[model samples]
Target: MRSEDALANIDVAVLAGGLGTRIRGVLGDTPKVLAPIAGRAFLGHLLDYLSAYGSRRVVLCLGHLADRVTAWLARGDSAGTIDVVCQIEPRPLGTAGALGYVRKELRSGTVLVMNGDTFLDADLRAFVASHRLSGAEASVLCVTVDDASRFGRVEIGPDSRIRRFLEKAPGSGTINAGVYLFSAAFVDRFIAAGAVSLEADVLETLPPGTLNAHIAKARFLDIGTPESLAAAASVIAGRES
Candidate 1:
């Protein structure tokens, strides 16, 4: 579905709380989101993309040198419309914990969540509309990836409901695109499960047919390591040129 018609009332949550342990060798102490790509901080590019799609509000879940992020966002003033929420996990609380920490703030309606380290050329509107219409507790953005061995792969049933979630297996399949549209209630359930992976803690635990998948048409990039970051930079540069 087209973005214009799909995401009329959804809020966006960008998970930005990682330590960047993998890329620290290259970026040294810089938050991964602040890593330079195409002459601007990577998070800036993400915010620009979200704004382009008429995002109602953006909540950035920040941690690990989060002060730098706050200062950077403050200096730009472009993020004034974006809500910056801090999720300072005493230690890495894993992905689901960060979301749980902010459950109260996510007090209403469905929310679109994306990992700070990956990018997908998805129709956000269609993703959200599909989640709402499916009546599933959660909807994951999925894409066919050649190297499913490095990512969590999801299996959807004939009815389009998620049947199983496999994390980083040595095989090929449709993988999680690091983007999701979830009903608020589903997030609360994730919080109740304690600190664990989103895929392992929540997606895997859902009863059959409760979770759905929305296939996207965009290129997918996971920017977790230096190599992937360089690849993402090249992709962004080519798009601009």
Candidate 2:
């Protein structure tokens, strides 16, 4: 699909509600996504990347220091073109549950779900294309890492359907990159169910073929920890240059 078409047809929901507890030792009051990197708020780079690719609409699912996140958005940080909406959570909700909280703000037939604390540098358009081509209710972006021990293993069928998700253990295999595409019908059903974890409650329980995979060789970063956040400047700089 053309870039403009993709922009109009897809809406992005960024799950940024996490409390930044892991890196609180270092960042203190900062929301994870707002963590400083390359002399700018991390969310700015995220928005820039998405906006560069014609992602016009983005909904931020907020929790923890949600007010800070909304304040950041209120600035000119959207970088224009990309429109952003921040939905704050009164209570801590799991990943899927967070989306359920802001189900009303989602507007596209296809909503691209992104983990707030992580960044997967890949083609969002291709991810969307794969989901539609597979004709699945939900599709996850999977990557084969050198070591999946930290994230656990993902066993996918030969047909690109997700077979199983393993626990965090020593292994090198395909893993969910924390990016997903969800169909409207599935989103409505999932939200209606209420208060579900995306991994344990949703994907893990879905039928084999209903949840599909879009595997990509992408650069992944989780800046939720101090070590990763410290190293992020170099990682992001490399991408920029």
Candidate 3:
């Protein structure tokens, strides 16, 4: 399928189940995903960007203050014409586990996975195309950042295979932007494994050739910390999807 066509058909799973330990002080009772940036919920901005995909299906994997997040989603202010639904986790289910919880709802096709707390403006069309071309079970959106110390770095081999996943340290490297494209079969295996982190378990254990990397220097932001959240408003202000 073409990139835009794939995006429209793909099921988008936004991981919003994280407990905002770092930002809870700033946001109080509000879930981290609902933290406002530039006069809108951070999720609003995310959905705005995702609107470009012309996708009408979005599944929010919700935890920690799920009720509040559900209430906000109920207001119907964030998703525009998209159909946004929440899959509340009974308990903390890590990354893969959360996805597993909602596996039944996912259609048979590629699924686009994104981090709710981080925003990386990678080209979806190109990313999806790369995944389709690679014939890998999963593909990661990698970004060449000046400093990779803040995040775990991903090393790409000559064939765009993920060769090494390096630990965080002060330096430069290409890092996973926390966006992924996965085939339905891959997701089924992940869900069957149960209670695993998408990165630490699935990605880390997969063969290098199974995970392709598409590197791009996209506009990015991580609102996991107070410092980043404070900077979000300025960074995202007046930006259009």
- Full candidate order by lDDT, most accurate first: 3, 2, 1
Put down candidate 1 lDDT per residue, 1-241, tens digits, no spaces: 5554354356777788988888989988789888888788888878767766766567777878888888888788344445555555566677888787766666448888899888766667777777778887788889997778888788888888888887688766798888888888777766876847886777777787787888877678888888899888777665446
lDDT of 2 at 164: 83
Q: Which candidate comes out best when scored by lDDT?
A: 3
- Could you list the CA RMSD of all candidates, in the order they appear? 2.3, 1.5, 1.7
Q: For residues 78-126, write the lDDT of model 2, one tens digit per residue.
A: 5688788888888988898989888889988888899978876787778
Off by over 4 Å in 2: 3-5
What's the CA error at residue 221 for candidate 1, in Å?
Answer: 0.7
Error of 1 at 125 (Å): 1.5
Give candidate 1's error at residue 238 in angstroms.
Answer: 4.7
**Candidate 3 local lDDT, 26-100, one digit each (tens):** 999988888988888988988877877667788999988999988887788886777887899999989999899
TM-score of each: 0.89, 0.95, 0.95
In candidate 1, how many Å is residue 233 off? 1.9
Identify the runs in model 1 with alpha carbons over 4 angstroms from their true place: 1-8, 77-83, 170-172, 238-241
C-alpha lDDT values of all predictions: 0.77, 0.84, 0.86
